[model samples]
Target: MRTFDVPSAPAFWQDPHSFFSSSETAQGGVFASGDGAVSVLGFDALDQLGRNPALDGHPFPAGGMGSPGLDALLRWGLFALTAPEHQPLRRAVAAGFGARRIETLLPLLRRAAVEHCREAARRGQADLVHDVAAPLAGLAFCALVDLEPLQAGALVAAVEEIGRQLSPDSAPDGTEAAGQQAEAVLEMLRALEAAGASPLMRDIAERLPPDTPARPADLVAALVLDSIETMTAGLACALDCLLRQSGVAEAVAADRYGWPLAVQEAFRLTSPVLLTARMAQADIAWQDDIIRRGTTVMLWWPSGNVDPRRFERPFTFEPLRPQARHLAFGTGSHSCLGRQLAAMLAEELAAALLPKEGQRAIRIGETVFLQRFARLPREAPIRFA
Candidate 1:
């Protein structure tokens, strides 16, 4: 119940496992980071954070939301919505990511993976982050949204530039840098608009409320950018996890059916999305403390994933670990709509990238953290043997 200034130490970003453990020691399961951000640690607290009705991802001033520029975006996008307004969009997005949809896209996913991996083979060494993860998100996203696949490379570039400018590793110059990155993300949408709306935009328009102000292209373009950020980072993280754990690839190879579990375990350990701001929908009591409405509490995921009380040796990579529980895609109505696709992409990519028998094991290079976000990696290079 006491306040400790949030430690923004370098170790917290580069070596978070120890950093978060030290935070648990210093602040217990819940403590306020003097910067008006309170981190809730531990697996139990995370479960509560997920189910707690009073907590939601509505964003706040400190959370980098509610700019006049983002009005149409938040109004139409699932990332910022809450309650009744969020339900419809959530269902629509969910339908888009249904098992059938992912299954239908599997062939295309495999084709794209083959193309990227083949390119990596030709080069003998490639950054999987760029060659594998980014293209996977770009091409798969376009296919899902019914957009022309030709625009994918541009989306990949825009998403990367946007991520680079916005990540914590970038050491943002201040509000101006953020404003610039924000404009760049919007420009990605403009680029999409200039090319004209595809059937994807029309489908999204049918799902959104008729009163929504933005045209279908404008709204869908904004939403796809949001999806691109999360999807790209997530695929990169999952693949990076596989590269980090040598034993994992063997386990995956032994039981190709278990790639899903490998991907799940990967998500548990090094999720790109570590911090989520949840505004108190109403005054809510937690562990004898009060969370006031308008309060933006931070749900720090790294602490929860490694909470000693839950998984034994939480940091150890265990692809076949029984019963994985993670918040990589968040929870509740605000949970990621493209989550299944991300997982599917990860699973399929693992199958594609797995080194075959008699072939040398894939060699992994060192990790480079994204400048704008410490939790996410910037590049993961690999050399096929």
Candidate 2:
């Protein structure tokens, strides 16, 4: 049995295959015997194991007991709120967030991103995560959801807090605070439903089957919350990659095509969501391992992204790689709804901020990996002459 020490906290930020690669293992499986779970390290392995409903069940972690049933309530509430039932809502929302919508928004998004970056440049030093990425992502999400600026910011903060609370190391008080914030956001959505202010909600209301119990408010609220949380994390991860890669900043300035491809590579490399969890519905044998019914499986996307078998020179950033298949937004039935929008926003921000020749170093300060940012400093001493 192979043994590896597990990090105290989930090392979503760290490269998991750094210590050991599946090629090194005697058998195909990257078994962390100490961690008591099999690591799906390759894209093929991930494709087979990650989406297996019997193995990998749902993305959200199983709820903790005795929390006023807050997690369950939130899940059910979201399911009840989106339009055309849960499954249909997923399909329609995906359609709405298609390539067409993203293409249309590119110009406007690019303008906003550039202006924001210019403002940051003038400041000499700014938190890239907070000042640039966060705001840009929040605004992009708002545009997609038709939310007002101030309301979008609030929603961003609340969703960020929820992500923070999911961390194993979060303080009890902080977790409680996040729950309250999420509840408040839900209340706001409920109020919006009552007032009939949002056209998206109205569209959903009109689309639902006559017998469906799902409400438009529930769907809208769930999408809003999910979009802000995931998009913000994606933005931060993309910025971190841009800062780390040599010449990427200058490349963004020089070539328009460079930034978009670079953003895609970054997304492929630094998958913001570390692992997705799923509960087993039936007994299954995966490779040499037997996964019994009711066992929880974790599909590790970060590990899969770096798997050498799947990605050639996985650690190296190759913007022009011809074939790049990444699970950053997930796969199959649970794939992210805002993927195109998220990609557009990230690309636009990179193009805007990294351009303008002779900009100073973009520094990243303390960041919480998958949680809220403590600080992200992007300093540039600009000479307008």
Candidate 3:
């Protein structure tokens, strides 16, 4: 295995914009050094690397805590469900997210968005991250997985715990708690499978061929874990953007597509998954740097997204800026599976909050790098008039 040096202070994991700004050379080049490889990509190079298969698949390092033995479970689940052996099962699951299915669910999503706003209005002052964003994300996940609406909150909490456990500094007690939660979640999945109820469970059961070797519990666990972590982080980032932007909340309420674009822009700026790595299949030269066949390649999504050479006024939050290609959801086979769902949630949440005017402006009180939120105060005191 090729050895790579850990980044001393990775801006992608902390403040992505500052990282790019600091790394910019007088010649308009951005130098990236990590994992014993030094490569420079012009701001515009993101298109070539992010979209093109030849350059986009480089593996990058993962920041933060390692999941305790759960990574294996995730890999196994993905292989069993999406690999060639499970094509039929994959196709079946995809049907639930088909155009018709998503269309059918749009009304429910709108209602949920309205209800979330009503509840927040009742509280007057609410923690936007926990009370609003979290529940909104949870509901989106529930829709994707076909879980009961009432169970979304608990399921989201369990998934958040799993993500927290991935942090390297998690104490023994925290780890123990996470394990317990995981077990409980697994048990719930088992119970759901046994009951043969719930559209999601029934669809999964019916679609997965009898001869397939994938277990229901493993599949459910993977879905729940992946759904929760990505959705929560994405929603938090989206909310952060609305709080920073002027009139975005109102625009979202007035226009259906307005907030979704803003959310996408935020995703580009604050890539939730900072670094991803892939082992080189063969020796390749990247802009004069030779990457040997066995080397592990790391792709920096945040850096690539904001390269001044690529994005005009890269630091500014201009949602209306013409469509710019970004690596927020990644590319090729490894691209995120739930990009559409994330966009939908961001749009709905922004729209819902727009009507409650005179609410306190949202503020992020304390932020810990790589951690979702320590405290996000949304002291929006409001009443539904």
Candidate with the larger lDDT of 1 and 2: 1
What clash count goes with each model? Answer: 9, 8, 12
Q: lDDT per residue, candidate 2, 297-337, as tens digits? A: 45566666777777788889988776687877766455566
TM-score of 2: 0.81
The residue pairs that clash in candidate 2, if any, are: 57-278, 57-279, 58-278, 81-218, 81-219, 82-218, 82-219, 127-376
Segments in model 3 whose C-alpha atoms lie over 4 Å from true places? 1-14, 22-72, 77-96, 198-212, 249-257, 356-361, 364-385
Q: On residues 62-134, what C-alpha lDDT tens digit does candidate 1 reach at each position?
A: 4354244433334556655566556665565555456776678988898888778777777788887777887
Off by over 4 Å in 2: 1-6, 9-20, 23-39, 53-73, 76-86, 206-212, 249-257, 356-361, 364-385
Best by TM-score: 1
Q: Estimate each model's TM-score.
A: 0.85, 0.81, 0.76
Stronger candidate by TM-score (1 vs 2): 1
All candidates' lDDT scores? 0.67, 0.62, 0.58
